[model samples]
Target: MMTFDPLGDGISRVEHLDHMGDDLRVVNAARISFDRESHLECDDTGQWLQDQDEKLIGFLAENEHVSPFFHPQICLRITMPSFLAHQWWRSTVGVSRSEVYRRYVVAEPQCYQPPHWRLRAQQPKAGSGTGELGAERQAALSVEVERLYRDIRTLYGQMIQEGVAPELAQAVLPQATYTRWIETGSLHYFVRACGLHTGPMAQRELRLYAEAVSEIVGGLFPVSWKALTRHTAA
Candidate 1:
C-alpha cells in the first residue's frame, strides 16, 4: 500500500488501497458506446495504449464526457482530522466510506497537532485562511492547544474505563481529533473531489489530501488523469 503523510504530520495520512479498472477500461467504456472496443497492445516492451485511443480519452475529457471515467474505481484509506473528514463526507455521489467506529474502539487515539495557526483571509473567497501567526503567538497557541487536547483525551479514556458509553464519550472529543476511514469511489469522483478540494476556497489541510490523491490517481490512470485534471485545473 502506498501512503502519504499530510504536511508530514504522521497523525494525518492517506493510503492508496487498491484500484479497479484502468485507462483502458475508461477508453473501452466510451468505445463500447459506438459498438467498438479498444485494447492495449502488448509487446516485448509490455503494454501500451494505441495512439488513437489515447487521443479519444483526451477528447472525452476536454468535452466533459465523464461517464466513461466513472467506469474505473479507486479505494483509499485516510486518517485525518475529524472536522476535515466531516467536510469530505459531504461528498456522497459515486462514493461510499466505512470509518472506524468509536463505539467499538475505546483506545485513546492521537489527535491532530496543527503546525501553526493561520490568519483568516477576508478576500478572494469566504472561509479561507491564509498566512500564519507570528512565531511567538504560534508557539503559545500550540502549547495551550496541546494541553487542552491532552486533558480531553485523558478524561475520555477515564470515562470509558469507568463504564461510560464509548459513543457518548466520543462526542466530547474535539474537532482536531484524528479518525480513519476507507473510501471507495469512481475515477471521476476522485478527479472532481480533488479539483474542488485543491481550490483556494478549501481549507489548507484539505489541499494536502487533494494533492496526495491527485498524485496516486495520476499514477494509476495517467492519460485520463492528465486529461481530466488539465481541464479541471483550467
Candidate 2:
C-alpha cells in the first residue's frame, strides 16, 4: 500500500499548455494553491529529469491541440516490480517513485486486498468486469487470502531458518504483495499514461489513485482537466 504526502515548497508552480486563448486566470490560481516541492534532491540527475519533462511539455504544446498541465513535481507511492518501475521511468515524466528495498528494508509477509468486483469470478481469464461475487463468496475469499498470507509468511520464516537466502526466498512472493511508491509528474502525462492502463471498471485501488490525481489536477486547471477527462471518458 502506497502513502501520499503533501507537495512542499519551491515546487508548486503549475505549467500550462493551452491553445484555448482564454486567460485561465482561475485555473492558474488553483495551481498556485496546489503546488508543492517533492522531497527528492535536485541534483544533476534530478535536473536532467526536469529538463526532459520541460522538453516533453514544450513538444506537446507546440504540436498538440490539447492543452497540458504540470506541477513542478508529483509524488506517487506505488508497489510494483523493479521491472515495471523501469518501464515507468522510461516515460521521462517528472514523477518520483520511492519503493522498499530488500537490502535496506526487511521483507514482510505480503498481503493483498482482493478486488471486490472479482467475487463473481475469482479468476477472470479475460480480466475484471462489473460482475462480482456475492457477499458470502467474497467473505470466503477474504478468509482464504488471510489464511494463505499467514501460511506464506510462516513458510518464508522456515526457509530462512533452513539457510535460504532472502533473495531466493523472496522469489516465492506473490504478485499481490503490496508495495508503495511516490510518483510526481505533469498532469498532462499523468492523465495520458493512466488512460492507457485503465478501462471501464478498473480495479478500485488503481482507479481510486488515478481519480484522486485527476481530481487534484482538475481542481488546479479546470478547463484543461475537463477536456482531458471528457476525451478519456469518451
Candidate 3:
C-alpha cells in the first residue's frame, strides 16, 4: 500500500470536478467523499480506507471522452505575493482571485525562496541571466539571505511580543513575503489567459499554478485540456 501525502506539495488538495461534465460527476463526487473521509478520523478506519481504495479503482475503470463542464468553474488556492497577485489579476479572462487581507487575519508573513541563480552581479537591468555562479558565491549569498530572513523573523516575533498589532507589524515585512489567494475560473478562460502566448516572465508563478490546475483538470477532462493547450499554443 503506497500512501501518499498531498500536503507535501504547495498544492494541498483539489475538490471541484463538476467542471468535467456529468460523466465524471459521479466519480468526482465520490472522490470528494473519499478525500474528506480519508482526512477525518472515522471509527471504522479500515472500512474507510478500503472504501477509498475501491472508489479510486472504480474512478479509473472508464476511459471515455466526455463534454467538459464549463459553467461551474474550478477554484485553486495559490500562495504568492501581492506583486505577483497583482500581475495575475491583470488578465481579464474569467479569472478571479481573493487574497489574504492586510486588514484582517494577520499572522507572521510568509515569503518566497529566490532561486540561487539571481545573486550574481544583479544581471542585466532587463533581468536576463548569463550563467550560474560559482559555489563560493552561491554559498556566501545563501548565508547572507538566511541571516537576514532570520533577523526579520526575530524582529517580527519581538514586535508581536511587544503588543504590536499583527497588521501593523506586518508593515515591516518585505513584498517578497508570501500571501495566498483563492483563484476561480472556467477552464477555457484560465488556460487562455495563462497560456504559452503570455510572456514567460509575466506568467511564471501563475504558469506554475496554472500547470497544477491543468494537471487536476486534465485528469478529469483530458480532451479539453489538450484542446485548450493547442488553442493557446496556436
State in Å the error of residue 85, model 1. 0.9
The per-model lDDT (C-alpha) reads: 0.88, 0.49, 0.54
Candidate closest to the true structure, highest lDDT: 1
Error of 2 at 114 (Å): 1.9
Per-residue error (Å), model 3, residue 127: 3.8
In model 1, which residue pairs have backbone atoms overlapping below 3 Å? none
Give the alpha carbon lDDT tens digit for every residue of 81-194 in model 1: 898988887678889899999999988978888887888776757465667899999999999999999999999989998999999999889988889999999998898889
Question: Candidates 1 and 3: which is better by lDDT?
Answer: 1
Model 3 lDDT on a 0 to 1 scale: 0.54
Cα error, residue 16 of model 3, in Å, equals 6.6
User: TM-score of predicted model 2?
Assistant: 0.56
Q: Residue pairs in steric clash, candidate 3? A: 110-178, 111-178
Model 2, range 73-166, lDDT digits (tens) per residue? 3444444434334444455554445556553444575455554635333555435555778888888988887788788888877887797877
* CA deviation > 4 Å runs, candidate 1: 124-129
Task: Give per-residue CA lDDT, model 3, range 7-113, as digits (tens).
Answer: 23443333432342422343344456456432322574431224453344333333321123244366666665555566656666666767788657656666555
Ranking by lDDT: 1, 3, 2
